[model samples]
Target: MITSSPPFFVPMNVGHAVVTGGSIEIVGRLAGQWFLRANFTSQLARDAATSLDVIYVPRRQANLELSYEWAPGSAMTGIVTYVGDRFADAANTSLVPGYLLVGLNATWALGEGYSFQAGINNVFDVTYQESLGFPEPGRTVFMAVTKTF
Candidate 1:
């Protein structure tokens, strides 16, 4: 009778989970703009002790995005994140600490149908954990361009 959790786990033991998120955007004149966004979660681990339960984790916990285009050919965008830890540790793999990530993005219309966008993530590149025993990527830059059809 090798029972996991001694048949007594949490009221709801959500197993390892992975959440995906992203956004789409369009810039117009007069501080006009459009955007599309979405996010989702991975799977849940129902069996731990009996299984590996090494994929336990939690959701981002918190997220935020802000933008301002008060001048012509210029725009500024900002984002914040609070990621929850998702590691392997039986009972609840989602027992990692949370963290905050601040970012700022700017864009300038270089020409018609052509614009330049530059941004920074974790500008501080603060070290954090991506997993239980692994470190997440450090602060990085995000740049891009657009040309409508």
Candidate 2:
């Protein structure tokens, strides 16, 4: 039996999609002055109809952060991140390679809600893409000074 009602059809969410994943996080002190933390995720998000992988959804991703307290109210933090390969489209036609990023930040807290901060990202000037057609930014530096009343 076949019946056609309209030329145009609208898509609706029938709750047929399912995504499963798990993450692990660890935080601890390295020696006495440094704090270390890490996180990892393994996931699979898919569409039931076409049985295709989702766009920009990597199966594996992880990050790490290390902070050192050189003195009171002053700290330096370093971060590392990894994103596994993934598809650009639903059908998985276009492939995007995995990427790693490194960053560093330093913060100094002054008296009376005053602080100074600076950081640099993509320290190696890595060339990569975070999405399909968009190119990710390369080595960037930023700084900020804050005063609160």
Candidate 3:
């Protein structure tokens, strides 16, 4: 008989789960008012019983952002994210592919107590799923205004 630990943590369940991972993060100024930030992570989670890859845990992930501050009260930012392929089930039979996403946003201070912001997400409208049987939203745009008393 073959058995393995749960691929993911369960509520009210007690057991030993072993996972090894590492991450890298960077933040720096690019040029003038331009700045950049990035992060990357790699991990391996396995089921002790069968030594199978854990479910819902990607092996690698990354994020990057670039921004520019122009003038006194205005700025623009761009972002990118990536997730590597991994198993969807403890058996490791179900595989999820890696994906990349991009976004852009702008912000402006309108006055003493008001501000405006707008952004677009998933600029390429790439189809992908963060979980099994669930589809993430396609390209989307949003705007917001804030005021302080």
Cα error of candidate 1 at position 47, Å? 5.2
Give the local distance difference test score of model 3.
Answer: 0.82
How much is 6 displaced in model 1, in angstroms? 20
What is the per-residue lDDT of model 3 for residues 43-68, given as tens digits with 9 covering 90 to 100? Answer: 98776656777676788999999999
Candidate 3 off by > 4 Å:
1-14, 147-149
Tens digits of lDDT, candidate 2, 31-51: 999999999999987766666
Clashes of each: 6, 0, 1
Q: Please, what is the whole-model Cα lDDT of each candidate in the order they appear?
A: 0.57, 0.81, 0.82
List the candidate numbers ranked by lDDT, top first: 3, 2, 1
Cα error of candidate 1 at position 138, Å: 1.9
Note each model's CA RMSD in angstroms.
8.9, 6.3, 4.3
Clashing pairs in 1: 16-55, 16-56, 56-93, 57-86, 57-94, 125-139
Candidate 1: regions farther than 4 A off: 1-56, 71-73, 90-94
- Which candidate number would show the highest lDDT if scored against the true structure? 3
How far is 34's C-alpha from truth in model 2 (Å)? Answer: 0.8
TM-score per prediction, in order, is: 0.54, 0.84, 0.84
